[model samples]
Target: MNSQIKKHQACYTVADYMSWPDDERLELIAGQIFDMSPAPSIKHQNITGEFYSQLKQKLKGKSCVPFIAPVDVVLSANDVVQPDVLVVCNPDKITEKNIQGAPDLIVEVLSPRTALKDLREKKLLYERSGVQEYVIIDPLEEYVQRCWLQNDGHYGASEIFGSPEALALQSLPEVELPLWEIFGLEPPEPAIIWSG
Candidate 1:
């Protein structure tokens, strides 16, 4: 018997990726599909964990529900996404099936395979969707960059930060999250980096 060949499958939209039953992690960048590496990098996990801890502590009893992936975020009918950490504050937006609307905040840790798409395609989607804040953390660069969308419904200039910068999220006017925590990446040193 002769072995038959298989045809390559094509995914032309984020919706196409979302409807698949298999748990093959993937994301669409400007309608071009990219397979996600299995499990995020350890450095990425640490950063995400630190951010989640800070956010969970601060948003306690608040309306915002912070979702850690593998939660599907539908940026559009065909542009589904999964940010490392996403905050949904609008009660009507949260749903039993999915986050049906714009998230209040979104954070994604960058990897070599995903850096370009996250910085461009996803960034634009979040902006147009009225996600109030978008944060992109680079493990290699040790950088956390954020953009607080302007009232005109688009992101203005961005705020670039490093280990020393105290991350001030736009949605939480009164709270300031220290960068040292998010980038600490491990148990903090006995000595505090800076006295606030």
Candidate 2:
């Protein structure tokens, strides 16, 4: 291998990652840098916002806190990521700067720009980092799949949910998200009706 390439592959730590320019988005996985570009689509943003709002509403006055994107979750010195949505039940792991460890539940909304990495690399990273649950949302397909960390420290079989049913968070069963509402397929029940 060439010296320049080898030098670049020497595995950057969290300190190195923090020192880089923030003009564009990037992720660090296993000491490798992955560029996040092309910006998110409208559907992706909408889906992310829906999930965040629902989760935030459910977690109100609760120990578990929900965070949206651009919040750094530091999995390791060599691995850091910004999940679309993350819920942390453990207060100690959270700090003003970033999450110091794995969150209880993490959600990533799929886009053409990040589908592969979110499913493959980020999946493995979260599993290894001891995240209790990982959810992948495909906005275009209107499907959500989740995998829970098994007792053996690996992810269990995936549970897929499509339109027509609300998504029940295994980590937070009390919180049920109406998928149809989130995807904007069905109108929310009318709050009130006036008859004169």
Candidate 3:
């Protein structure tokens, strides 16, 4: 755990990334190997799971297929990532090994350890790669921020949405994602038995 395959100090290739052990969770961004160790928080997992379930249900008979994390999304020779959830409409891009290109929609649930990279580095990379929609969910705030790739090849202003409000997917207008179902943490109910 102490040692990480640092990115800036050493340039890594996709082949090197492929040869890494299965236990090691890592990513390659712009030829830099980034260690994605330290698993996501419980809340992060909850949000990701619920959101993925909803997406899976919605895309059930459709061309778009939903994939959960730990699946390599090969953006390029130097850039490979594992988004929390992704929807790939192009079947050809999805091979047994990994997603060969940018997914139609990529969702990243922000955690303390990954917020900076998810919001900044990955945001830029997704936009440049022409991902149709990029969704960033803040588990702490319980809100989802969305960015759409514009006609000019740039991401437009992000639209922030919270619980009770639906997180609309620009790429797939028919799909409805209610924030409460994804990020809501309901309190436990009080004991109903009365003292007789």
Candidate 4:
């Protein structure tokens, strides 16, 4: 753990988190503060926007609503995260202040600064908090990894998809995201067959 993070671990709470300046982007997990700094790259922003756009278009007028980042999802007093993209199916969790419970789906676009934490710490947090689906996109690699909560109350192994494939979301059956479009990649050409 970073020395600064070590100092804040098991010491900070949501109250302290709320008292911070608006410009400071931080996530609290198990009472530890993780800084979201340096801003994301243009590629990262584009990918995040594409994912949100697709979710918004698919979920329009539906009970499930999609949200972009900077929205607090309060899993507990000591656990709050702002996923890059998220979907909440229950209206009650959508509060004027922040989401009070787990979202149905959470997406995090990996950045070099936060990739390991997103894959390990945040993954465990979402699993224990009962998030139904979690997606991690790597803009550099142009691939996505997804996991869902299993009946055993833990996340199953991640299912990986490349840019050419589409991801069918488990939380919302009707929603499928084109990975190529999301990653800003050219879609694979259709296969041709010779007539017999």
- TM-score of every candidate relative to the true structure: 0.83, 0.90, 0.90, 0.94
Candidate 1, poorest ten consecutive residues by summed lDDT: 1-10
Q: Which stretches of candidate 2 lie over 4 Å from their true place?
A: 1-7, 187-196
* Per-residue alpha-carbon lDDT of candidate 4 for residues 1-196, written as tens digits (9 for 90 to 100): 2333345345788887787777678899998888898899999999999999999999999999999998999999899899999999999999999999999999999999999999999999999999999999999999999999999989998999999999999999999988999998898898898899
Q: Write the per-residue lDDT of candidate 2 for residues 67-141, one digit (tens) a residue.
A: 998888999999989999999999999999899999999999998878999999999999999999999998888
Tens-place lDDT per residue, model 3, 16-123, is 678767778888888876678799999999899999999999988999999999899988878989999999999999999999999999999998887999999999
lDDT of 2 at 74: 94
Q: TM-score: which candidate is best?
A: 4
Sort by lDDT, best first. Answer: 4, 2, 3, 1
Q: Encode model 1's per-residue lDDT on 1-196: one tens digit a residue.
A: 1112111545356556655655566665455555676678888898888888888889899888788877777666557777899899888887776788689899999988788878998999899888999999988888889999898999999889887667888877756888877887443356657768
Clashes of each: 0, 0, 0, 0
Which candidate has the top score in lDDT?
4
Candidate order, TM-score descending: 4, 2, 3, 1
Residue runs of model 1 more than 4 Å from their true location after superposition? 1-15, 29-31, 185-196
Question: Against the true structure, candidate 1 has what lDDT?
Answer: 0.78
> In order, what lDDT does every prediction score?
0.78, 0.89, 0.87, 0.92
